[model samples]
Target: MAEVEEIKNLETNKCKQNKRKPWDDGPCLDRWEIEKFDPSWNPSGMLEVGSFSRAYPKRREKHLLKCWPRVKSALEEHGVSCELNVVGRYMSVSKTKMTRDPDIIVKARDLLRLLARSVPARQALKILEDDMAYDIINIRRMVVGSKEDFLIRKIRFLGHNSSSLKALETSTNCFIRMQGNTVAAMGSFRGLKRLRIIVGTCFRHDIKCVLWMS
Candidate 1:
């Protein structure tokens, strides 16, 4: 009985020692052979879509038509597709069957948004690059006064001949456009950060003061 018990203990220890961890398992067959039999591994047909709308698309129709071909071709090079709906005043981008990089769709979306904000198509294409960024700062709610007061602030923000505006752009290395009540800016990340600070100071203090400091 003692010998049998010792044998049993040895067998249990051996079993524990022989037990393989999940990470210890090796592939039994080639990766291609295994994937070939996987019914749920198909990713080629998956689609992702991004849509955009603007307040005034009619005004941009001609511009869009002129740039759409180039935009479509550019996106196609990255395995994405784009479409413009003149009647609906919207643009849409989607991943095609050839799309391998998931982040390309997001870049395409940003491209459409920049274009919708009246950014020149040539400049807007820069959003497709890795280090480019953009921001839309709403100045309408930044003031605490009437419309006239806001207008005054906006005027101050853009000095005579837009000298103050150009100075801000130069100091920050950003391209800025004042569209309605929002300021659209695009550049490198560092430039955009500096731009936000300059815009805040322009609205909070005097544009002349900010320009002088810069």
Candidate 2:
């Protein structure tokens, strides 16, 4: 009986060891199988490695010690003269043109804010790409508005999944962020015009009217 009990205990311990071997309960690997990596046979297939270096030339009047690639691209595309320069511990910005203009300065600050926050840099820069001249307005700026006007009923992904959001962006030329139950959109005059039409037709009862006044 004693011998049988000892054998049972050994078997239980062996089973526990087998179960724990595969689990990552420890910091280091006890055993590893290193096979020769073949890109062709890889499930993901030779993925491209990412780099932190800037591909564009850093020669411009404006200097920002560091800026995201998307931010720099948007600035260059919009004819905003700027460059990046590394200061002691911060990025120093130098702008040759439109430095004194309040509107341009405001837009620049907004752009930086969006990029620095949780928003993706590419999505944030969409505000800079506009076919029509439009004033940028924040939702907080409008203190007075109808409840119907402020409230938006979001039709989740329209028909498809998240690509619908991208479709809306392409169609309306807007940068849209989905909040808890509604969507926050940023666009130019023309883009907003299209978006308003979309809301009226698609959303129907949610929006009574769309109006913008300078």
Candidate 3:
């Protein structure tokens, strides 16, 4: 979580726009500090491609077909090993039903992202807290740095619900947030990339002024 905050302060809020996003196409090393980046620094690029769909470039129906395998392979190639878990589904054992899962899931962050414009944070944090518990349980076997150390970049946040995040302060990187409660994005700015997409309306409609997260 702290690492995510640190990245938000780096490139996302720099206001230095280019043809490609810093995350999707930029080097991991800082441009000013290092002349050459470590060639081995090959973390999977956080794919927050557009304002509407996070990581999901298109509709979620083809999520399995499009995003998962490439990301999984890329992480493995760089030797980042963690269980690949899909955490967004609610199953029905009583009868067969459609199973909708986001493209990729890291931890509890998916709750807000998967919500789209559905629920409010005040209403949803409970579930998110539980999911966080589940997240820690699932990743208890992680052998590397703590969960707060992992970096997230170039992700999208589609809704206006900025409950606890410091997104409004302009410190984060490549955030691409949709302002206010409106489903459509207000504009793009930089923050840690962790936006998600789900089926129903689950968040506020427009971006509010001056977040309380700080």
Candidate 4:
């Protein structure tokens, strides 16, 4: 009986030792699979080794830093200034995440008008607004989104100046809206104090986010 008990204990210990691995938890595919790896049988049809995906996981800060500088530089090349602010929720002893959700936001007025138009513009505005309003004050700034991406929405792309005015009134409070056909400015952050509250409230991406304002 004692011998039998000892054997059972050994078996249980071994079972515990077989811990699950990272790949066992979730597959990392979004990072990009390394292609043309197996150059033996078919030199042209090599399968992806998946080095990049395997190398790191997506962490918001890292990803933003990695891409943001290049993106900012590119924008400057075209004569548009760029800025980024970040807000943090918490810190964790995490793994190799390459990208993370943007806690910091980027913002600029009519920044992308020259590049593209419409849905892409609206999408960019929405993302920017969401991030800016994030609780992380240090990292909060209204960042601009890509007009190319904005084109996807296709709906809140454009509006007659008169209609947008109605939207501004019904959408937010105490803010002034100056949208004369094309350019727009819808914000409660008016008159001197620059409260940024009223506009903050009614600020919708496409439907309400101002086109341009002086």
Report every candidate's CA lDDT: 0.73, 0.43, 0.28, 0.31
TM-score of each: 0.72, 0.36, 0.22, 0.17
TM-score of 3: 0.22
Q: Can you write out model 2's per-residue Cα lDDT over 114-145, one digit (the tens) per residue?
A: 44333455556654432323233243223244
Model 1, 40-79: lDDT tens digits are 3445644654443333367888999899899988888877
Query: Measured by TM-score, how close is model 2 to the native structure?
Result: 0.36
* Candidate 2 lDDT trough over 10 residues, lowest sum: 205-214
Error of 2 at 106 (Å): 1.3
RMSD of each: 19.9, 23.4, 18.1, 24.4
lDDT tens per residue, model 3, 1-214: 4543454454344565634564665656443331323323434443332112223222332443334455334334322322322354321111011111122223123433433333233332232221121111111122135433211100122223443223432433222223232221111111222221110101211111222133
Which stretches of model 2 miss by more than 4 angstroms? 1-102, 116-118, 126-157, 200-214
lDDT per residue, candidate 4, 104-207, as tens digits?
A: 11232322321112212323243233212111111012223455433322223234545644554445432232322222232323221222322332222322
What TM-score does candidate 4 reach?
0.17
Model 1, C-alpha of 184: deviation from truth (Å): 0.7
Q: Output the worst ten-in-a-row residue range by lDDT, candidate 1.
A: 30-39
Clashing pairs in 1: none
Model 1 scores a C-alpha lDDT of 0.73
Pairwise TM-score winner, candidates 1 and 3: 1
